[model samples]
Target: MTRTATIIGGGVIGGGWAARFLLNGWNVQVFDPDPQAERKINAVLSNARLALPALSDVPMPVEGKLSFHDTIFDAVQGSEYVQESVSERIELKKKVYAQLQQANPGVLIGSSTSGFKASDLQEGSPAPENIIVAHPFNPVYLLPLSEVSGSPRNTTETVERTAQIMRDIGMYPLVIRKEIDAFIGNRFLEAVWREALWMLKDGIATTSEIDEAIRMGFGLRWGQMGLFETYRVAGGEAGMRHFMAQFGPALKWPWTKLMDVPEFNDELVDLVANQSDAQSGAYGIRELERIRDQNLVGFLRALKERNWGAGKVLRDHDAARAAVFHAQTDTAPKAEPLTMAHMQVLPGWIDYNGHMTESRYYFANSETVDAFLRLIGAGMDYVAGGHSYYSAETHIRHLGEAKLGDRLVGTIQIISADEKRFRSFVRIMKGDEVVATVEQLCLHVDMAAGKTVAASPEVWANLKAIAEGHAGLALPEGAGRAVGQKK
Candidate 1:
């Protein structure tokens, strides 16, 4: 069943919520009094369109409908979920919640308030049991973390159901067992932010230097292992317990001014703003955002390769998406020479020659194999069961070049197959032109035993059927070609 989400207050956070829901196949309705709400949300959606899909190889669900409304009642009337992202003002939030409840008494309400606790949001609500804090970080479409908390009045079911919904939309819902100010993530962020501010106030570091300190050092570590685990590694052979024992004495060293607040008067504000401008004002905000998005894509892809931390989240999400794709395609008529893959050449795939590099052709062919594996029901579960196809031999012929941003598609024709072995040829095309071809030989492996094995009866039957269906087609022109002629 299609789901609907209504967003109130189409600012950065609200726009992000819209993107997250809409891209995940939820019809989104947005209500913001500001005249520029539509334009701002559209801009966020544009960035999301580029960044989100690049995170996974599996195809995403088709986008849901998005409609902008002038009033809260119209937006929330039929929505199953209502996300409130208006200003941080307490009374404003209360007003919105009241309106939302009046509009749809049974719908769940989640507030995108980074600072307010769920109890605070529930203070004046008529339907407090349905309201929860679903605070998400900026660029919510890309980042998976969402801090969720429910008030005392909220039922346990509400929180769990909200968490499941968040997971469906590719978000990690970190539920706060008890409500507290700033939730969880922002508390840690606040500590760092306060230290940075104090450093700036004391003239110890410029904005760029502070940013460099994090990005060039701890930021990379935090992306995967986080602070405590990184420090655990620092403990040598002892691990986290010993590390804390060794470093615990420094707690009173006055190393941080966590309790101090720098006055936000004009002089300090100007000083910080001026330094920030001098540091990064060369590029406009959009360019900086694009650079940030590209860097995130590359970093996340690296982490995905290792299946660690956020990368693990991405891998699991990809598997789920692939499962859905397999289910949908399994019932549909199989296209002869199955269209196994379709994707644009990502920026990282390009070379100095302004075209996709040689290695990427192999990467594309590997993706075709993955898609084919899923199509035949030998997917994640099959691999998990200690059997999988291992490539034994491959021959590739690069016939043409593909540039960045070119849409590439791969089609596979089964050349031969049996219980223990399969061989296939994959042709990659840029539109109608053949860009490359790879002929691959694969053996079914009992992974634990480290040797070839016959595939299960079901898998063998599926492969045999596909091979027989394509038996009448003519052999590809270069099917048997070698590097040297018979001269």
Candidate 2:
């Protein structure tokens, strides 16, 4: 079933969330009071057009309906989920909720408030259970850090459901078990900020120096493993207990005022802002933000593959989204991945021309086979060294055409195997239906003198075996067509 999410405010975070969900295939209804709502949303759509379609690990899930609404109620009229990202004021939030409750009573309501406790935010609501803090970090599409909190009874379900939704849309949702002012992460940052201010005031360190301390040292560790996990590694072979035994004594040392809070005043605010302006003035806000997003995407994708917590979430989300895409599109099941060599197409490969592009089809088939050869240790170097190459000598008659919306596959089967030469017959099929047959002759060439030559002993032997096994494939029916052709 297609999901409809009503986005209440089409500002930066909301726009980003819009992009994320829209990319993951959710239809969105956007409502923002600002007269510039269309321009704001279209800007986000422009980014999503480039960003979402590029994540082609799977045919990206169904894109949601993105329509601008005159009022919040219109946006929420039939939404499964409602994400409110209007201005963050207690009174403003209450008004939004009251308006939202009047629109739809049971649909989940997520506030984009970063710091407000759910208790305070949901107070006096007709159904406070429905509203929860789904506080997302800035550039929500990229950072993926979100803190979700609500009243004890409903918060867990709300968090779990929202997190699942976030995962589907490729966001990291961190649930706060208990709500506190600003929640756990920012509260911790608040503590550090209070102390860091004193250092700035005292001229103990430059702004860059404090930031460098974290970025160069601890921040690298923070991306993969959280502070606690990294500290456990520091404990040595004995782990956290042994490390605590050694370093617990350092608690007595007078390290800086990590516990004290500094006074916040005009002078301090100006001092910090000036320092920030100095640090960042080399680039505009837009450029700086783009650089940050690209870096975060790289780090997040890397960590995700290692099955670290955040990475695990990303991987699971990826798989889930892929399944959703396949199901929605009714894409046919692909052949088992090419452990040896194969080419299979899901429905999305079909083009508007009613046939797959010739170049893309070739590219897809070659990559599938390349992946197989790579697993057996014959990759770029194996061919580039000019020792082994497959030359398409002849492509026979097309048995049938693969239509625009058909699931098709192709396979290359070896016909003959020799140390110096090899032959293969290729078949393109639409399910059980054969569409085309290709026959190719290959040679081991040593381009040292631009001449055909034998490959390395080990490589030739490995190739000979795989080739011999596939040589028995019933010679692709049109094999004789190219036999009498001139060079």
Model 1's C-alpha root-mean-square deviation from the true structure amounts to 4.8
Worst 10 residues of 1 by lDDT: 326-335
- Every model's Cα RMSD, please? 4.8, 9.3
- Give the per-residue lDDT digits (tens) of candidate 1, residues 1-487: 8899999999989999999999788999999999999999999898887788778666567689999998888999779999999999989999988888998898898999989988888886777899899999878988888899888788889999999988989888999988889988899999998899889989999999999999999998998898888999988898888888999999979898898889889988888899999999999876887788878888888988999877888898888876765553332224368887775676567788879899989998998888888777788899999999999989898889898557787788888899999889999989899999999999999999999999989888888888887787777768867776441
The candidate maximizing TM-score is 1
Q: What are the per-residue Cα lDDT tens digits for candidate 2 across 347-405? A: 33556765655665555456444543553345688767655455536455555767533
lDDT of 2 at 13: 82
Whole-model lDDT values for every prediction: 0.86, 0.69
**Backbone clashes in model 2, listed as residue pairs:** 25-62, 26-64, 27-64, 27-65, 28-65, 304-311
Off by over 4 Å in 2: 44-56, 153-159, 325-363, 366-487
Error of 1 at 463 (Å): 4.3
